[model samples]
Target: MAVAAGCVVATLTADPSWAVQRPDPRPAAQPAQLSAPARPSNSDLEVVRLDPDPAPPGGTTTVHAFVANLGPETTASPFTITVVLPKGVTAQGPFFPTDCADLGDGHVVRCTFGPGLKEGRSATALVPVLLSPDLQLGTLTGGSVSVFSPDDRNERNNRQSFDIRVVETAAG
Candidate 1:
């Protein structure tokens, strides 16, 4: 503290031991380079639907939904298939994969297949469907099967429509 012209001034001086050390001017040493893991390859998936044999209006049938990898590479992630049935039709379980679930008013069914679907290999879901007893006898349209995957690159072959043919049960 100093006083000049009847005014007092206070100054501050940090001790050398209290001074912070300056960081190195050059960039710090980087960690050793590590190779990154290989990325999952893209795949092309195709969906096919096989309608069951004609059954009576009140009877049951199965829809065979098949998905194949038309890949230049094998899938490294899981994929899904969804079945949307027409009015008056419902999907029942004991489904293939055993994990298939009916969603939204019993008209839609979804099934999942895990990773490692090799190129040219395929998987299928057997969906049992029941027709309303009052459903008229004929072909029921508007039913579709679609596939989805984070790795599938082709959307053109991801979906297909199927028709359920209904016939009158023959008398014994």
Candidate 2:
């Protein structure tokens, strides 16, 4: 402390003849480029296309599914997944770890995962498909699936569509 004081005194006394300039405590006015920018947060959700399986007469077929989290953020809350079924296709049930419901309208099936999936993790589900009782050999179209979350970043991969053909078998 004494040495620092002596040095300060000497510096002041030596520069007495000239005016001493002190730096401004307040920051200098500068463009935004002078400051570093914050890093971008990643929150992405994706679902694979739902393919159809053969549901022959009185027999059931399973359609496998996959969901992936290719982001930097964790899904902090539960998120719902809706799989819109195509024509002539019905969701008998969804084999998933979470609570899944078949909306009975034959158009929508929903699944909710609580506490959500972590980043870089993936989940799978098996859906039981059957030919809508009245239809025989119809093309299934206009099918899609979406992951409902506010934090999703890449919308392109979030939803997908598929086409399927169901033919009536001898027993069907």
Candidate 3:
């Protein structure tokens, strides 16, 4: 401290007329020039589609979907996956004991199940869909599956869709 003070005193004495002390000048930092962002390669964000289970005429198919956090982002909560019942099929009971229901699109149903989606985590749900007795004994096709991010409250994300197909049921 004494040596620093002595240095300051010597500097001030050398420039006695100066009222205020001046600090050494430093180089100013230039504003950073940001480069344009790279365009997406069409290879990013691949969404793994889900498929619905197939049911046969006069039979019941319990569809269990494997839901997973298949993204790099950490979901604050588990994602809600709704299985909308397709045509010729009927929902048996309450979807999940909560804010979800069967919209009964004949081939589509919506369900919301929970907690949250952590990275690399997965969950599953059972969908009991009863096929109509009148369905032809051939391969019944055209089914859909989907998942959303509604936190057990609302379903604002409906753009996501999954593909599902059902083959004909065999004779009992």
Candidate 4:
């Protein structure tokens, strides 16, 4: 027996002295047809939020943007994570990936991660944020974090909204 293209082939042989002089009534064997392997299925990438610590107006803080693959398959392509800050906050870089791009006048940032993220594995982006000096002391809403990839098909869990609470600084 021999294996070829995911198929098995068998061969048989007989001695001439033991064989009758008659035509064999079996049909000839045909070559096996080979098909291309199927492509991998889509992955599931989710944004696991890690909200920033409360900071006073004009103070700086870090936003932990955690992303995970709740995947049945590993990623087959690269993906990107975007962080959008609220009105009163802005991104101050020294970002985790070092290549994270600041966009929309510092209120938004985009970070990239290479493929091959296995199930339960995660990637994180640390974005330093600075609150405006004249901002009010309260929860700053409208901030968001989102993920995108050609290998991910679940759109529902790809994005999540966040809030940055601004508090008053205590003087020692």
**lDDT of residue 56 for candidate 3:** 58
TM-scores of the candidates in the order shown: 0.75, 0.62, 0.50, 0.75
Q: Candidate 2: misplaced stretches above 4 Å?
A: 1-41, 57-59, 136-138, 168-172
Point out the higher-scoring one by lDDT: 2 or 3: 2
What candidate 1 gets wrong by more than 4 Å, as runs, is 1-38
Q: What are the runs in model 3 whose C-alpha is more than 4 Å off? A: 1-55, 94-99, 104-108, 150-172
- Rank candidates by lDDT, best first: 4, 1, 2, 3
Ten contiguous residues with the weakest lDDT in model 2? 1-10
Q: Model 3 misses residue 75 by how many Å?
A: 1.1
Report the C-alpha lDDT of model 2 over 1-172, residue by residue, as the tens digit: 1235644743335455657787789887578756744333456889977576655544456655567888788766566677777767777764564477777685677877754578999776666676666666656678777776666778788877766566676542
Candidate 4 worst ten-residue window by lDDT: 31-40
RMSD of every prediction: 15.3, 11.7, 12.8, 11.3
lDDT of 2: 0.68
lDDT of 1 by residue, 25-133 (tens): 8875555424432356689999976777787888999889989999989998889999999888888888898999988688999999988999999999888999999
Can you write out model 3's per-residue Cα lDDT over 1-172, one digit (the tens) per residue? 1235644743334445766677769765455434533221211111234555555567777655555554455454435565655567676654444455666553555565544355566655566677788876555444445565522222333334543344576677
* Cα-based lDDT at residue 47, candidate 4: 97
